[model samples]
Target: MIIESNDERGSVNRSALRRLTGIDAASFAERHWGTTPKFTRSAELSGSFEDLMTVDAVDELISERGVRTPFVRMAKDGRLLEKNKFTGSGGFGAEITDQVDSAAVLSAFAAGNTLVLQGLHRLWPPLIAFTGELVRELGHPVQVNSYVTPAASQGFSPHYDVHDVFVVQIAGSKRWTIHSPVHRHPLNNQPWSDRRAAVERHADDSPELDIVLEPGDVLYLPRGWIHSAQALGETTVHLTIGVASFNDYDIAHHTLGALQEVEGLRAPLPAGWDPTDSEAVLPHVRRVLGDMRRALDELDRDPEALQRITERIASRYDELVRPEPVRPLRSVAQMGALRGQDSIRLRDGVIARVVRTPESAAVVLRDKTVSMPPQCADALELLLGGSPCRLDSLPGLDTDDAVVVGRRLVREGIAVMAGE
Candidate 1:
């Protein structure tokens, strides 16, 4: 299915979500999210998998890149191979534990072991781009892992993931069996192993869905859904993109932290508090609870405070972002060479938004915030539009002021030189 653009602002472009699920984002969220499993079959999606990763690319990462453990793991007959079995000293006198032993990995693969590539989004360029887009669309952190299994072999036992996963069949085919969750809406700390007997029984019983996923098929399983997969006739390669959704616990934790600014909330509890005597602690507890209630009420009424919390949670995911390597001398030279006709664009994965208060305006990106004078508001707005704009074309700033703003953006890694 083709992704269709939407005109609504701040609404998730349903195109990508539709491409994966064959349904609009809103419908999917309303109907299936954390409730059931979904399988979408499309011929167009099969070819798009090649744009994310290929068999040749996988081989290159394993053999030529010297990838080390825990990045690459091998599993056979439901058991994970130890890191020492597939890793060893690096070549050219590098550290003893720095490289993966490609020979050992290939030998294991030939013996019917499934090779699992972890965190491909961090190591593979294609996945980095694709998963980054997924993160922005879903407003959550996304991780990608690839599983290459031999024909007629299974990699792991029946289990459930703590995070929701989109299973993209990239090559060949695999048979997937999905069962009802042993625990509904399980948190990250909950694992299938914690309910091993229940999971085993569920796997043996009737499942909600059982089907062969061919190339171009996408299967989505919410957290805590029991499932397992085995390769079909040909060797199978599939990508599993995990989405870690933020929940109420995260908001509550941040809210508590924000409430720490209240001096009453920061005061220590009674030194001789008696745990068994409710009367002894009643006064102090009542006061503390009252203070917390009032603080939270105030925070809910303050838009700026709520926005700060939202930005904080959003920026926390930026830790997973790997920025482009900046060359000091070259970047400085590029900044100095900027001309009035030169066009610049925001770097990929660099998010910039202008935050305005009555007194001042600030451009916030990732971990950096640059407060600017009120006069630069129009120029900042133009730059934050995220398109290529010539320096001289800024709406309000003159050539000199524009140069200053442009230099600051470039130096702060928010924008890059697009073209002359």
Candidate 2:
């Protein structure tokens, strides 16, 4: 169950989970990852997340950022408040009617609403970096949201998330009441609302863990673990980093999808047979199942089938997570200003693959594909090998040709200049 990753230089990088939980990835994977809950104090982990978030930062985002609906939401007594309560139009030049009204947010907060800042990883700089690192570490897409609760208030009712979460307490204290899962390892399509009766019943049973989380504390809860939290005396702000991990079902789904090309599996059942009659349908079902079993066995032995599955999973990853942010204007400028002395490398967090077709060598990015002459295949490989290389040093191409290729890559968002 141990999770491991290598840097571009092939050295093992420290695991982000270990950094956050003060437990190495091997032990965490063996014991708590997708298995159980583990809570650790701030003193135990590397350090407090004061640099990541704070009360002042929250104020700035609400009052200055011109945030809109879906980004800012408020809840109280386990029910969400209407958007109209804290949202209104920006006057004159900017007329987005649903922008958050800071004054209204203050009034709502005073009335005991818990502010939920969704998608903080995309909004806040520090969280953007941290979440990206965690995604790389776990090979799972990660998202972050912040919960700012007023004293003596609860935001949501007892419920379970479909994704695993690391709850990092940043300010004040909050008491968390945790219970064992009513339905273990629920998928994205399986929500607590689907089984509310069972969740509520389990929530009422004797608690499994109940403790107050002070600033610098963290709680790791696997998916489907029922839990609820209430803010303590002072206001509370915490970040919930959700991990949408791929599982066995995903592998099987892609594998079966590849199997669709098999002729035997696609054959129709007995045309005149009564589907409702057990005697008539049982043998047909068994025969089809036997055919599918044989097809699966053949697929297991075929390397090409495994390659297709890997590509399918990689495509799914491309859809789930975004690469590092690109500055369009700056990057465009850098493209035109490329110099032989400038160092460039593949953009961090980018999902790309160098593919060779009969016609050309192409670098496939999430959003687009950049194609080059077949002569550039070796140069493309050298450029995308993870480490930064100078524009003049691209192996096959001369200085001028190397710059041309480098500029194109930068312009296409496949690579970036060093120190960016």
**What tens-digit string does per-residue lDDT give for candidate 1 at 1-420?**
112335342323224465577666677877886677889886634135677777888889998987877888999888998888888888576776847888988888889999999999888877776675666566667889999999899999899999999999888889999999889888888888999999998899998999899888999999999999999998899999998877777778777878867787777776877878888778877887888899999999999988888877666657655554455787799899877888777776666788888776798877678887777787788777777878888877888777887888888877788841
Q: Write model 2 residue lDDT over 205-292, tens digit each, in one string.
A: 9899999999999999999999999998989999999999899999888988997899777777767888789988888879877888
Q: Estimate each model's TM-score.
A: 0.83, 0.92
Best by TM-score: 2
> What number of clashing residue pairs does each candidate have, in the order they appear?
0, 0
Question: Against the true structure, what is every candidate's RMSD?
Answer: 4.5, 3.1
Global lDDT scores for all candidate models: 0.80, 0.88
Model 2 misplaced stretches (Cα beyond 4 Å)? 1-15, 267-285
